[model samples]
Target chain A: MTEALLHVDAIETFYGPIQAIRGVSLEVAPHQIVTVLGANGAGKTTVLRTVSGILDPEAGKVVFEGKDIAHMAPDQVMRMGICHVPEGREVFPFLTVRENLMMGSYTRRDSDGIAKDLALCFRYFPRLEERQHQRAGLLSGGEQQMLAISRALMGKPKLLLLDEPSLGLSPILVQQIFEIIRRINQEQGVAILLVEQNAHIALKTADYGYVLEVGRIVAEDHCATLLGRDDIKEFYLGQKEAGVRGQRRWKKRRLWN
Target chain B: MEDAARLLQLVVNGAAAGCIYGLIALGFVLIYKATEMVNFAQGDIMMLGGFVAYSAIAHWGVNYWVGGLIAIAATAAFGYALDAIVLRRVIGQPQFAVVMLTLGLGFIFRAAAGITWGYDSVGFDTPFTNKTVKLGGLILGDDNLSIIAGTVLLCGVLYLFFAKTRLGVAMQASSQNQLAAYYMGIPVRNVFSMIWAISAGVAAVAGILLSPVSMIDVNMGFLGIKAFAAAVIGGFGSIPGSVIGGVFVGIVEQLAGYYLPAGFQEVTSNIVLLGMLFIRPQGLFAERMGKRV
Candidate 1:
């Protein structure tokens, strides 16, 4: 009922001639966590990239805080308080961890607010504080993920578009990162639009979920309802039935239509 | 004692020349760092700066300091315009195209300078003309001392700029990963233009320093080839490495010209460059870490 913090209308994106995302629409309310669940090459990353203005969409709109930012540059999008933690944790390799965090606040001019944010980032990820002077490339995968998330937080974003937070991490680290994500959402009241392959944790953490196939959103619902669906269980939750793969595939096609 | 004094003098002279080469090499590193494109016009830009300063001082009758400032400003604007007009269009193109574009631009700049200023070598009058300073046992020319002092001062300023300033850090961030920097609210295109401008400004300073020692001419742009070798030897990514590499090349060239065959001065830098390529293609201070995933 209330207005969404971010509204993504039916956006169509392309890579040269090949269309990557076709008419994908989504929304995230203030302080809510919405997850987009799909397998690799299902246009999950493309959706995030389109919203973040890295790749301009050929159609539809990206409205952030009631402003149409569909044609803005990536930096202009970030200036409007939308921070994107891209896939692969592209932290500056040669920069120290502290400097990496500093880069997150590049748009801000308030020194006091920046200092506060830096302290807050270090508090959330104490390992960052411990190796604040160390180059970011030297950090372990889990640590780098933490640094990446914390770096996004430093932007003081009203909405965070996370590409993949649990990518290439141990189970324990995934849980830890998800816990931090939940805490960040709740404590900071920051909205999140998360794209993930780990449907279990994503469904557990997010309030709403969307299922994407190829470049289209096939299904979407409240997380609790979606988690209980048969298709979601069979496809995303890894519920396997011997000799039923083809049958399930046909059934899924029927369901999508 | 005489031998020691002679060696010290050679070292000092080599260091002065090396600093000029390093200044030009710094331009190469700056542009290469920001865009991964080598600007072959760097040396020609230096020559252009020298001519600009010469015109300002000789024809316009401006003060020496004012002329130097004009030279730096003019060259910086030219560099910025070059990036904005030509290089910006071919940003994501192949490296070979960028290289050839810059090489062609270098030739254009050289020809422009020759047509504008004529081919005759001209002397630049500086305040330090014919001045010399006596050290403990050695005589040091004011020109060499100023070159060394100018290099040290410029390096210090650059170090502080990169370490302490926000715009400088943003430039560094953009150089490392432009997309990530853009996501972080840094205008990456502006940062690239600024890098080119600063590089050109630095090259101009090198030209101003070199002009007082050697005559200013279009052929002075050929010195950029040596600076290119210096950049390769120092590791293209490292700023400090460029200076050290420049100095090493300068010393080798000086010593070779003195001790080896008459034509060996020109070949010494290439020999060192080939040797560096064979032994350590990554250069002396190249980052050892594998690319991040």
Candidate 2:
């Protein structure tokens, strides 16, 4: 797997006394799209936060590009080529769209490279170019998400960590965003670790998938194989027929007896 | 003709004083914008700057220009230290705790200044002292003109700093969202300290300008309350609002002192502040507070 671009090995992270991620481990290979699928409150966001240095894991190491970055600050982590697109698209509302995109390249000194990336970003999301002078706060949800993704791309990151990019978006918009995500991975060769609750779309878009339940991974498989599983089809794909619930209830009752 | 001349003279005087208030309020707005802390010590920092410059000029017999530079550098260092050593520790704590800490620090600065320089008001010597420029029937003091020119120049430099410079833009981005700024590879903590240093340096300039007009003493810290009122009136977060608020407060105080009953000068700012709070709680240029989904 090309020595794995990001190796999050057996990391346990806590928020004060409550442990949010318990011995969770995952990896993303170079030029691959990896998705962590889970229900809400299943600690998917916690894993991404830990990997990106926003939260310190109590145990284990996060090796990125062959360096232990678990103890680094967020800015330091970013300098090492990891960019986190946080949950809820936390774009700088007061800054103009162009300024916000410029801020993404804050750590870099190569002006030519930055300018090139800026043009690339605008190309990826033409809406950003049309409203480059407008305040970011004025952008619609779909546009803001596009801006958020493009901003991360401006950093020229080796691995991008995206938390719930599809949340609260229309289905058509979600499809469009996923298409862009795939294009970014194929064209730019940037590794992506996507955390999402939209299991169906995530599995469809990703090459590999991990199923997180209650802070631990219960399933890991290639996206195509995982999509074909009966349990995944019934639970995550919402394929329950009209009589299926009753049949499953009777089957569970018999097992219990 | 005489009444019109008096009113013009009063307006000029008020504008000079308003410029000083605006300078001090700029410090408050800068610190608040960066750290979300109301630095009660802002006024005392000005007093400290005034005293420092006075000591350099009056006691050490340094050149006025040299003394002013020294005071600015010293005050900026002190401010940077305060944030790095003290305020940095209180980050993520309750807002009330940070406010009280600043209030206590203000008192400490006042007491320290009193101990070092004594409580007596001392004359502040400047090159502009006693120099007046005459234009027809009206006379303008060099000190007042200098204050006005200095305020305009300082504000212009600050505007360019925020609008044109890379570091300044990064600082503005950090002020807007620290976590997001950090995610963008901005050193947020260093930006906070830099904001403190700049605020202190500005406050020091205001103090040095003010001392020749009003004698340098520990009681000079009381001007902070007026500046605070200006910040509140301007909408706490806005920079230009601070200057406008300061000018508004200054004009109102001058008018109140001239036409109203005794002691009206003391309550004028508070009165305007209260009116502002009641009429438009969001300062004139309040940044739109949008909820992030």
Candidate 3:
């Protein structure tokens, strides 16, 4: 893609002393859905955090809209139109749903635009509107997830960093959420860098995909191409041949060598 | 009939005293809710506010109303600077260090105030001074009544600010989830400083309202100890609960002072505090919650 919206150039991040993301580079073109597929502790969330400025990379650049934003404060990155919806749907439990949504537009002063966006969020998640006055802590897990997405949308972000959107949801709910995410990207032109462990669905929803294995990128391809790869089908999709089920073995690395 | 009238007078006076404690407790609650640091200097801040108002009114010859407002604004700015210049650096420090820092700050404030305002207890005359209002055969000091009325009015304004205004909601969001608030483009550090300013401003208001009833002295900040009791009784984090707890302590103290021995009144609040801890340590309106994951 020409002129990417978010470009991560070999970022290396660490938690205390242990390196989490080592020499990982990727890009998301404007309005494109980019997914990072990995197992637990594969540094998927670390990549997203690095982009959103929650965890500053020890090295390399995170360039957004042609501006280098590595090591910037999270609020500054957010003000530059990059909103991050962290994992676990961290809603303000003490605040009502409406108040939580109001926080999304805290950086903006245009009341009319905020009100319109509020309406747009309610349109996407009707359940949120129904519980607008209730405390956010009272909402169900599914509803909280919906509220988290809608809250991010209210910020009118140019790039959205979403960590594990399909986490802890039924397959049907995941499908519904992903459908709205796709529509949001299509209609509002909000670029997304989604991180997920649910590889079966992540590939179907994203346009481009990156496979991470223990702090490094092992595979990168178009979503359709990644789906057809022999390794992906056998390991990620559980499409094993007869008598090969439940066996965990790796063929020698080929692409990098 | 005389005893009943005396009791009624005592109750009204107790309520007024309770309101002062409530306002001071509010300062503690606001700062604690936002930054999780207990400002042991909260009462000293109020003392400083009172001295400032006294200077503005007495030396500058300003009106009572204007001087009170100036004191509140000045104290609020001081609170903001206190956080920005010093407390912000200790964001990740252990809680015990903050307590020690604030405790040290309180001693410094007292010494500073003593140097500037002198060790003598000072007073200024107000419209409420030496005045009494009669209600149904019960006589009450106008000074005490004004404190109650002012607290109610201030609480109303604060409630509207927190519930209706965008900045107020932003403050709540920052206190609830700092990370999520940052994602929403909130300057969480600035928001925290603002919370400290509000807490200081509230303390200043309490000090000014208290000026007519009590003398403004360097040692007056010791009242903060009682406010701690009020906050604990109120459930430490809740707003309305703090005020209610203050009132309870005030009334009980008044009753104990009149009916029981002289020394018993002084220890009434402490007794109640210990009793509440034994019975329900969470306070009256605590929002006890464990962080989600």
Global lDDT of each candidate? 0.91, 0.90, 0.91
| Model 3 C-alpha lDDT per residue in residues A122-167, reported as the tens digit of each score | 9999999999999998888889998999899889999988889888
Chain B TM-score (each prediction, in order) = 0.97, 0.97, 0.98
Largest DockQ belongs to which candidate? 3
Question: Residues B38-118, candidate 2, lDDT per residue (tens digit)?
Answer: 898899999999999998998999999999999999999999999999999998899999999999999899899889999
Candidate 1 chain A has its poorest 10 consecutive residues by lDDT at A240-249
CAPRI classification of candidate 3: high
Instruction: Report the C-alpha lDDT of model 1 over A1-257, residue by residue, as the tens digit.
Output: 37999999999999999998989999999999999999999999999988888999999999998999999999999999999998989999888998999999998989999999888888778999999999998999889898889989999999999998989999999998999899999989999999999999999999999999889999999999988887888889987667656674776767766
TM-score of each: 0.97, 0.96, 0.98
- Estimate how well candidate 1 is docked, as a DockQ score: 0.81
Docking class of 1: high
> Order of candidates by DockQ, top first?
3, 1, 2
TM-score ranking, best first? 3, 1, 2
Each candidate's DockQ score against the native complex? 0.81, 0.67, 0.85
Better of 2 and 3 by DockQ: 3
Q: Per the 3 Å backbone cut-off, how many clashing residue pairs does candidate 2 have?
A: 0
Task: Give the poorly placed runs of model 1, Cα more than 4 Å off.
Answer: A240-247
Off by over 4 Å in 3: A243-248, A252-257, B288-293
